[model samples]
Target: MSDTPRATRPGKTPKHGTGGRGAAPERDHLRADCANCFALCCAALPFAASADFPVTKPAGTACGNLREDFRCGIHTRLRADGWRGCTVFDCFGAGQQVSQVTFGGVDWRAAPESRQRMFDVFPVMRTLHELLWYLTEALAQPAARSVHPAVRRTLARTEELTRADAATLEAADPGALRAATGELLLQVSELVRAAQVPGRRKNHRGADLMGAKLAGTDLRGANLRGAYLIAADLQRADLRFADLIGADLRDADLRGADLTGALFLTQAQVNAAKGDKTTRIPAGLTRPAHW
Candidate 1:
């Protein structure tokens, strides 16, 4: 029998509290449990040789660097070996959830028939987990207190869907689910951003601000949802209480920027950008090593 690879967890600690809601959500479910995973990411997904991966790979094919035990042989040296894309990918605990819970601990190698189904469920689980992350963040915002009850209800609904079987998962439409949750999150973000001092909030929601020079910009309580900020110069920018739900921060410079209270800022976005010691992120997100 082939050995299973153990998951490598991040060095950071998760945030505590009921995510600020009446019920304490399962925070552990959001973090990747690589040890229990079947290396689905390295096998099920496709990648191309670019500034990220070192080679091109087709879907359902395993990476050359994947060890026999389902571990990445170059895990610690992914960036050094021209695999930056692999380093930025965060399943948000979807890997383990699908491997262990959805598939009932049956690995693709052990049960070849389940391989295709495993690949199908992985992305769906990722989307559901992402929604959970945003919902948890919305519930924790004190300024969004008016929307907490609704957020909790949505969170429960979303969690229920994540536990579906393989066939149900394959038939699931994550786009519709994401759209529904996004509507509520937007409402919560609006309430929180509006509570800030008048005239200080900037509204660039869904704007294409790609590569704009926003260094040292005063963006307190700005609504930058879905903004394409790829490679923007944001050094020393003030982004406290900004709603960054779907902002593309790929290669953005965040050196010396203060994002202490930024909302819906995921670790994947931060990992794709540049930052330094002075780039203050939210408590849950860890600093990227490349910065």
Candidate 2:
């Protein structure tokens, strides 16, 4: 996956309402459940031939390696065959949501008329699910208690959007919603970082630190949000409590790096980076197999 920055400037907070019936689903619901999905990621997303992919594939077209049963033909050998991007790409459960929940288990093959619409809605749902993941994490931070109420409300609102019908989802504009959530997350980051780092903390938000040698550095509570750290040497770096949201860590050396309590770090980001068993990651994320 490319290390494109996803951060946006803070915007006005949006209004929230009481969420839909029943409590919000657990974190597991926000993760990609391929068993319950129709392989939307394989068909809906387009890719160009590069270091990450061996061949070019267009959007709304099933990958050449996709099997009739919706599984990758070479799942076990994706990376070895030069499909490294597929291993790190994540849909955050949006595939199953669009396939089973929104479309009621209807596969695009069964109803070709809905193919284009389904492909379009997939990305929108993915964005909403990604926001939900961050919002859920924000609510778990005790130091951000002051904003927990807002976080809960926003989570509910975003969840409600996920349940909307196909047409509604296709036309949904999550740009404003993303900005609002970004602002709230910034507040939470400040609260947690202030409490974790006693004195002056490094502020490197949006810095271009690509290929920089930062081994064994003290970066506790640092705001490295949206920084480009591609191919940088971060071995044994002290990144505890660092705000890593939107940081591009592709090919960055993470051996022995302490990412415990790192804020907004996603599995895709970790999977894209180089790490080892000694790298300490936050709870709930699996260590990359290549590490």
> Candidate 2 regions off by >4 Å?
1-25
Q: Against the unseen true structure, what C-alpha lDDT does each candidate score?
A: 0.82, 0.85
Candidate 2 — number of clashing residue pairs?
0
Q: Per-residue lDDT for 1-291 in model 1, tens only?
A: 012245533232233234443654656678776777788888888989888777899998988887767787877777787888877788888888888878877788878999999998998989999999999888777888888889888988788778878898889899999999999999988888877635657889988888999999999889999999998999999999898988999889999999978989998889889999889999889788888
Q: Residue 47 lDDT in model 1?
A: 87
lDDT of 1: 0.82
Give the TM-score of each candidate. Answer: 0.91, 0.91
Model 1 worst lDDT run, 10 consecutive residues: 8-17
Candidate 2 versus truth, CA RMSD in Å, comes to 7.2
**Candidate 2, position 244, lDDT:** 96
Which residue window of length 10 is worst by lDDT in model 2?
3-12
Clashing pairs in 1: 7-34, 7-35
Off by over 4 Å in 1: 1-26
